[model samples]
Structures are given as structure tokens and as C-alpha cells.
Target chain A: MSPSDFLIIPFDDWVNFLVRDWLVPNFRPIFRAMQVPISMVLKGLDDFFAFVPMVVTTLVFALLAFKYAGRGMVIFTILGFAFIDMIGLWPETMTTLSMILTSVLFCTIIGVPVGILAARSDLTWKIARPVLDIMQTIPSFVYLVPIVMLFGVGMAPGIIATIIFALSPIIRLTNLGIRNVRTDLIEASTAFGSTPMQMLFELQLPLAMRTILAGLNQTLMLALSMVVITALIGAGGLGLTVNTGLGRLDVGGATAGGVGIIILAIVLDRITQGLGEQKKVETTSLRQTLISLFKPGAPAPAHAGKAA
Target chain B: MTSKISVKNVFKIFGDKPGHALDMLKSGQSKNDIFEATGQTIGVQNAAFDVKEGQIFVVMGLSGSGKSTLVRMLNGLIRPTSGEILIDGDDIASCSPAKLREIRRQKIAMVFQHFALFPHRTIAENAAYGLKVKGVSSDERRERALLALEQVGLSSWADSLPADLSGGMQQRVGLARALATDPHVLLMDEPFGALDPLIRKEMQEELLVLQRTLKKTIVFITHDLNEALMLGDRIAIMKDGEIVQVGSAQDIVSQPANDYVAAFVADIDRGRVFTAATVAIEPSTLQLADDTAGDAVRTMEEENRSAVYVLDGEDIAGVVTYQQAAAADRDSGTSDVPIADVLITDFPTADRDTQLADLYAPASSGLPIAMTDADNRLIGVIEPEAVFAQLSADPATPDTEPQVEADQRELAPTA
Candidate 1:
């Protein structure tokens, strides 16, 4: 035996054996239960994207982009969508959108409450912080190994892997947002005799909405990147197009797919970022929102038009 | 009179083992000794006082002197390590969370130094916060909040957000929020401390004016001796976690309990704290309505006075100067035309609680300022000599010497 053999522990091999033999067998029922929601959401998004005509989907996105962002973003979204459609990658783009949106939905649902719980309890925060650090630091491909082992390969497993990779930002930011809520406001709420739940909903949550929305934006971006990577596991999206193009050594096709992703990322990033910007403002009047964007020196929104 | 809020032997030690620290404190260990031995910080030590109803009770101390902690304990915010805080007969130290909330909801309202306004909410909404927390209906909350805003003279800005208002106006909104709840007690923790000096003065005057009609039992906390003297009917002076003295403004300024309290008192602007009543001296003789001009002259000569109040029994009918009395005597050619003929009603009269510094303007009318009771009876008079003596006696040399010089210069032209 070589001298190096003495130091080699084979820790990874032992963990792999334990996970395959013990964890998978013992948690079969839990994994089975998780599959229901996962498949249902995946199917729902896939079918929804499939049924919508390409032109109609493009118009809807353009309209949303104009409403939240402005005229500038609307033009960008239209150009992006038209270019993707012209390149014959419209379906793949739609599937990718569906997967990213699905990941974002699940991450927000699971991350926010956990973040609030962690913020409220020091013990929970100590535990969640290290787990989040690890989740963020690990390579995205490592998550695929366990996801594939538990659920096998397909769009469902791909979606699960995207969620695992993207969930860290939302949880971490939500915890930070809640923790950073002004101590003065909290004391004021307590002095005014708010119930614990009332303090959470009326005071803490409203104040933290901007930071949490920023977290959501980060999560969305992460999920977008991870969805492309998940294409290696039979997930159908622009990632597949890019992957196939790369396999055949077709640089033109790969470049086209990369352009489509850049367009989509820009559109999605602008929309989520615009949502965060809107929260900094007190007024929700469409006229004011439009006016303020162009005229930086304009007065703030009039009266109490804050979104109740 | 029954005390509205009574704090008895209250102690607040902040640390992991506050109970052990409290036991050590009770066993006659000093705050520093306990802190050194057990790593516990004493927030307040053996603080005992009574806040009477409708009285402005000020707790004044420098930062880290435990004044804020003591006020917070009254509302059950900082739970005392030992002893009792009784608000209207209920011990707040032993209150459960719900009961404590109820007390805060219905009995006490606190105004913070930073205003603590919700930046996202409208001024009306901020004003109505307390009412909303008490589960008042929206319509009623709106109406009451508007009325409170009106009281603070901010009705026009109700729809504006807190960010839109200036700092002083925002603090007014904070006051309006507390008033909207209509609680019996107001706990103001240096509410005007963040304001500009001019605005701070205006808010202090505004609070005093509001107190006149509101009659809320106000426990005001401040690091300013001037503010404490200005606002408080009774002042409690704290130092290093212990209440060294508790009394009226006069009591604190005149008779500080120890050297620490004396140092605090020394920094006080005494002209502001000592009112006309505190410095006024009783007249030796008065001109009666029936007293003839000759009789008035004899009394003035005996007392060596330039002027005297003409009394209608206990009421101040008017003032009769020696010149006016002498001219009347010469014109009438007798001392018996009645003192009413020479009685001059144009002289300035001051109330007992009027600050001595304010007496300058009224006293500048070249008249001895008469101190009057609520019934307008002449109680005493403030002479230039008495005013200068008190001014020069002030331990705060900077505030006194200049003011005395100015007063001397202002009178020099007249003299």
C-alpha cells in the first residue's frame, strides 16, 4: 500500500453508501409525498406555457414590463421575445421561463416564513445561517446528484435542483430584512400595544417589504442560471438548445440560444428590480410613477395614496 | 392628594443574573462593587417617588444616569429587577403581558425622542396609530386623529406622509398620536431633544399650553435642567442609577441632597428656575383706600419706598407712586382727597409662577413689579435690588454676569 493510503478516509464513499442504503430507504415515504406537489407544479407550468400562443405570451410580458418598469423596458422585452421567436427557440424559451418561475414560486413560499422564524429566534438563526452558507457556497452540480438520486432524472428533478440552488438568497435576505427593521419602530409598536402578530404583519413586514423584494430578485436570477444548468438532466428549455448546439459543435446555434438567455435575464431582472424601486416611493399613482421617473426633481406623491 | 404614579424601592439590574445582583445591591453593596464582582450593570437603584395627578413630573439626569430606565418602568417596558411600580393603584411590575398592554393602551401613552414615525404612513395614520392599535374603528380613528392633529395645529398636513413634515412638525404628530388615544398619563422621553433650539423652545411652550387644558399626568424625561425647571411641577434628580433628590424646582435648586446633585444644580440657569414668587419680598406697609395723601407720605417715608400698592381690602385697587401722591397732595391742598385720586392702574403686575427673567420687560415700565395671587391680591413686590442679588447669586456664572451687565446697562440709560 502507498503511504497516501494511510491518510485516505473514504468519507465520501461511506456517505454515498449510507445515503443510498439508509436515507433513501428510511425517507421513501417523505420523498414520495414531496413528489406530488413538485410534479403538480411542474405539469401545471409546462401545460400553461404550452397552451399560450407565442404572440399572446409576448404581448402579455411586454404589457407587464411597461406597467412595472417603463417604456424603455417594454421595448427591450419585445425585441428580446421577437429575436427568440425568429431563431425558432420560442418553445424552449417558454419552457425555461416556466421552470424559473416555478422555482421562484416554491422558494418564496418556503423561504420567507423560515426567514422570519430565524429572525425571531437566535437558536433558529444560528442553525439556518450555516446551512444557508453551505447551500450558497456549494457547486450547483453537487445538488443535482442527491436530487437525481431521490427523484430520478427529468424536469421534476431539474426543477427541484434549481429550487435548492436558488432558495438561499431569499431566506438570508428575509432574515436580514426583518432583523434590520428599525428598533425605534418596534418599540413604538409595542408601546402602542400591538399584538405580536399585529407587530409582525403591520409593522415588521411592511417595513421589510423592500429588502425582501430585493431578495426575491436575487432568487429569481439564481433560479434562472440554475435552470439553464439543470438542462443536463433531461430538463427541456433553452439550456437543451444550447447543450445540443454545443454537442454538434454548432457555434451559431449556441450563440443564438445564449442571446435568448441574455434577453430573458435582462427582462426578468428589470421587472423585479422595478418592483423594488416602486416600494421606495410612497405613491402608487401611475401618473406620478411615470412622471417621477422622467422628472427627478418633482415633488413626492400627494396626500395619503400609499397602498393599504 | 393621592399619587397617580408611585415608584417604591425599584431596582433594575441588567445582566444574565439580575436577581443575584439585586440581592447583592440589597445587601448594601455599591453599584460599582456589584458590577465589578458579578458583571451586572445597575440600571436604577432604589428609585422611589410619587407623581401627583395632573402634575408635570420631570425626571432629569445626564445620559446613562438611569432616568430613561425609570420612566420606562412606569409603563412596564423595562421590568424592574425588584420593587414595585404602582400606576393608579395597580402594580405594573407584577402585571402580565396582556394586562400591561391594556394599561399602555388605555392609561399611558409614550412619546419618543426620535418621533418614531412610520415613514411609510400618512401623518393622519401616524397620529391614529395608538387608536388603531386599541382596535378603534377606522372612521372613529380618522375623526379623533384629525381632531388631535387640529389640536397640535397640523390639520392641514394630515394627509401628508411623515417624511414630508419638518422634524418639529413630526414631533407634533407624535404628540397628536399620544393625545388621540386620550390616555390619562403621558410619558414624554425627551420628546423635543432632537429639535432645533428654537423649535425645542416652541414645543416646550406648546406642551405647557396643552397641559393647561389636557390636565394629563405628564412624566417628562430630560437631560436639561432648564427644561426640567420649565416644565415640571415636581422634579426628580437622578445620578448614577440612584434618585438623589425629588422635589419642586425650587427645592432642587435651593437644597440639593449631595455634592453630585449640587453640581447638577450649579449648572442650572437660576434666573429661569427662580420665579417672581420665589424672589419677591412682602411689603412692610401698603396705601389703604381710605388712607389720606399725608398718611401715604408718612408710610412711604417710614418704609423709604418710591411706590406702594393701594389696597381695597385684600385686592390691589391700583398703584400710587410718591410723585403722584405728592402731586395730588399739592393739587388738593390736603391729604384727605382719598388715595383713589392718585391711584395709578397702569403699572405691570406679575403672577407668582412667572419666571424672574421675564420680569425684565414688565419691570422696565419703570415700576416696581407687583406679584399677585390668583385673586389679583398683591402678595409681594420685585425690586431691582432683589433681582440683581438673585442674578448675581446664580452659580452658573456665564448666564448671570452677562445678563446682569445687560440689565445694568438697560437700567443705566433710564437711571
Candidate 2:
């Protein structure tokens, strides 16, 4: 074959070459550097004092429930949050909480709109689907390399990697939510003389909210799990303590952090999934359920034949 | 009523290769060929219709029949492929986006089948959404929303979010939202199509009541024929992206234009449409002529008379029409009942829109209903002779008719 006719490498092949040659060799040093900034962001939160105030937390959580679930949900959330605290691990848990929350917030800010765009356009879905695939499928260790390159170690790098890995579900769910919004409902909003903005805010977004919440729920859980892996990049939280303890053969400290992660995961996941499922059950049309609910036999209204 | 909506030849062909699809179809390519070649689907086709002002216009068909697509075209939800949709004489197709927005906000509102309640907002907020979207102040939105909820009997549920409400309650909130907008026209695409049968009926009646009070011009879409008959002032039956027939339920049922139209009528239980308003009533017999038989004979055989309603001056008299009894071509065996002895449902008639269940008698076949003025003076008779002629064509061997004819045959004609 002529030299001009030769193909050197595909992107995937090139990617593998880079990971094997440059990425693995340089990754450890970058993770060592991420330790500083991640620690600073987390220092104030210490898990216990780090709490964003129970009242504020309660109110925010309550508002979320009122919107997506129902009123009684707020009470359960408050109790759950308090119980997790009463069990101690306050400062350690708070540090982990801060990491999870911040990671999720940034993820949402990026993920939701991408999902919405995906839902809106076929091209968007096609484009976004692959990016998500890469983000999700790439090894968790592989994520540390990019984080290390940008932040050069510490909590920041860990946060970045955590964000990359855990955020896929958020984007996926958001897209699912928007796409799942019933076309009939959207048309209904438009026919009602709703402006584009109104239709978005009133119908499309609201109906899709359940799916979006599910995405959020999944993302939060993913982020929580990844934060520990991010500890390898010096993003200190419960993960740091766990990793360090594991390194030193101190099973007690590492186990505590692991337990804390599980608690936070449970608390967050339950609340979110509950809200999404609740919204699903609740939003079905009223007139239909009532007549169907009461009895097998009901008066067939003559006017039903005439619903003009 | 003026025609509020006018659609002139609308088509919506969906595909990457509409031209090729249309060409191949014309060139004897089947649907599979069109699909394989272009990945195209026809959404709606050459749909032309109008809705009169203050009239309840219903579009009905089964799923994928393009009925929903036609409704979407009304308010520009989906622009037609090639056509002009005029609302109040203004063609919406060429209108500016700003104007379309204005028309939607000020002129049209839709009630959805799913209710589409906002889980984030309370009933009042969902109800007030259209107004809020229209830039109405908070106070007015809330006030109107509350009032709308009250109209739907959901005033107490106003503070509740959709999640707290039942499906039917949420639907009430949906209605409240549409009402809050106060648009000149309300478009409902299967608004109650999702409800259970009983609740669907209740909602239907509720809509009728609301329309009676509000008098908003309504354009409703549904698949159920009975719903169209009960709710529509006029119904437009859609099939294969075209309106097979458009008329009152009685008109469509009694006078179907084709097989497709006949199919719709056949599926519906005719007990409701066959009302006293439909059967012709008696006319006055004020002539003081002494010869009763001679007079009856002369009146029966009058030249301009297709059918005469026998009546005693605003009071009903016996109806005795001659349809097949005096046809140019009649079956020899059935003609034995002389024209005079032939009893017809058209002779002892009521109005043309009478309820079948109302006139429950031992026998009401071949009985003609008389049409009379308010003073009880007979004017005309609605003879069932036409109905009889239709059925009596082959009485010796009554072929399989639908359940409706079997049910209706139970009410025998009585003198």
C-alpha cells in the first residue's frame, strides 16, 4: 500500500493510545494535587456544623415535596433528615452531603437543559446520547485523568470527576422526562391559548417533572457513590477518611464513612423517587377517575353522547 | 350563527420525501412502497370544515383517523401543509407569529383529555395558568381561577395541588384553567375521552351545562359516536383524513350519505337520537267538509303532497302516508295491504327528535308522528313509512341488521 493511502488511527484507537501512554502515567500526580481546594470547600461543613440549618433544609425539602409529591411528604423528609443526624457522624456526613449536593447542583444546571433539548430535537437526542454513553461507559478511574489535568489534584479534581460520572443519569432522566410529556397534554396547553413560554412552564415541564425527578434521584445516588471513588483524587469527605483508613488498615474509620454514604443515599433516593411516583399517580385527570372509582355500575349520562 | 372557523383544503403529509411518496402512490406504488422509499406517514389530508359561531361542532373518529390532527390545525397547533384556516375571516396560515400568539391568548382555549394539571401548582394555580401566561396580574389570575374552579365544582379543591386531587378532580382543575382564560372559542380534543364511562357522562353533562351558561363557541373532538350525538349541535365524522359526513346526529343517522356514514350510525345506540323531536307531528284538519272518506282521500292524494300529517287543528290526528304503498315499483306480495289499510309510523307522529326510550309502548312500528304548532294545530306528519320502506324492502327475509335496529323494533307503533 502507498504511504498516502494509510490510515494512522481512529479516535477510539487514539484515545486508547493516550490513556495507556500519557493518562495512566500522569493521573496519580494530578489526583495528589486536587486535595487542597476540595478540603477548603468542605472544611466549613464538617458534616455536623456543616449542616445548612435544619429549618432551611426542611423548608427547601418541603417545597420540593409540595411541588413534586404532596404535603405529608415534607414531614417524613424532616424526620428522616433528623434521624440521620441523631445517629451521629454529623461532621463527616455533612462533608459528604456538601460534596453530593454541589456535584448534583452543577450536574442539574448542565444536565436538565441538555435533556430538554434532547427531548425537543431528534438531532439533540442523537448528539447527546453518545456523549452520555461515553461519560457512563468510560472507566471510573479513567475520569480521574481529566479531573487531574484540569484541577491538578485535590477536592476540585475529585468533584469534577464525580460530576462527570454521576451526572449521566440526570441528563438522561431530564431528557426522558421531557420526551415522556404526553403530546396530547402539550397540544392541550397550546390549544388553550398558552404562549410558548406558558406551555413550557405550565404543561410540558410540569408533566415531564416526574421523569426529571427520577433522573435527579438516579444522579444523586450515582454522585454519592462516585464521591468515594473521587477520594482517590483528594476530594476529601467521608470518602477521604475511608480511603485513608483503608490504606492504613483501620477498618473502623473506613466502615463509618461507608455507612454514612449508605444513609445519605437512602435518605435522598427515597425522597426523590417518592415524589416522582407520587406525581405520576396524582396528575391523571379528575373526572375520569371519580366515575370509574366508585362502582361497576353507574348512570350512563345521555349528554355523554353529546360532548361537543 | 356566522361561521367562526373555515378550513379550506388542508393537508399534512409527514416524511423526508413527500413529493416522492405522492408520486409513487400516484404511480401505483402501495403504502409499503411509499413507506420503504420515503419513511413518510400521512397525518391529515384535504380536510375542510367550518364551525358556526356559538355552535357546538364535534369532530369524531377512532384513533389514527386524523381527527386529532384536524383539531390541532384549528388553533395553529400544527400548521396545515397546504390550506388556509380562517378564524373570523382572517387566514391564520399567513398571519404573523405575534398575531398567532394573540389569537391563541385572546380567542382560543383548550380543555385537555388528560387534564394536564400542574403537580407543582394547586388547583387554583393550574386553573389560573392561562391567565398568568397571558400576563394577567396575580390577583385577577387567582380570582378567575377560583371562579373557574367553582364552576367546575372544585372550589374547595382550589388550594390542593394536582397530587392531592383525584383524576376527576384534576380534570375539573383542567376545565377551570380553560375557563379562566375566557377565550371566545374553547377547543376540546377528547376532553372527556379518557374518563370512565360514568364520569365521562357526568363530565359531558357538566360541559353541556357550562356551555349553556357561557355560550362559548366550542369545537370538540371525540371518537365516541354517542358522545358526538349527545353533545354536538353538529357533528363531523372523519375517516381516512376526510369528513365523511357533517350534520345533526338525527340527520346523519336517518339520512346517511354513504357506507362510512352508515357505519357510524349503525354503531351508535339509537335510543337517544330517536326522539319525539324527530318523528313528524299531526297537522290541523279544520275543513268542515261533510264527506270524511272523500275528504281524507282527496287530502291524502294531494298533488304537492309527498306525505300529509293528519291532525285536528294543532292536535295530533292519525298519520297514513303512502310511500312504498304508492311507489312506481312495488313488491307485489307486500302491496296486498291496500294503500288505505296500510298503517305507517309517519301517520301518528311526534317531532323528529323524540327519545326512543320515552315512547316505550307495546308496538310503535309503522306509526307516523304528527307535527303540530304550539296551538295544537297539526301541520305535518313524520311518517315511519320511509323507515318502513327502508326495512320493508325485503320483509320476507329480514337480513342481519345491527343491534340498534333490533332494539328499536321493540317499540311497536300504537294508535
* Number of the top DockQ candidate: 1
TM-score of each: 0.88, 0.68
Clashing pairs in 1: none
Each candidate structure's count of clashing pairs: 0, 88
Could you give candidate 1's per-residue lDDT for residues B57-131 as a string of tens digits? 999999999999998898988899989999999999998999999999999998999999988888899999999
Candidate 1 local accuracy as lDDT?
A: 0.85
In candidate 1, stretches whose alpha carbon ends up further than 4 angstroms from where it belongs are: A1-8, A281-284, A287-308, B280-309, B313-348, B361-369, B380-384, B394-415
Query: Model 2: number of clashes?
Result: 88
Query: Could you report the DockQ of all the candidates, in the order they appear?
Result: 0.37, 0.26
How well does candidate 2 score on lDDT at residue A191?
A: 63
Candidate 2, residue A168: how far the Cα is off, in Å: 2.0
Q: Model 2, range B231-260, lDDT digits (tens) per residue?
A: 998888877666766767666676665666
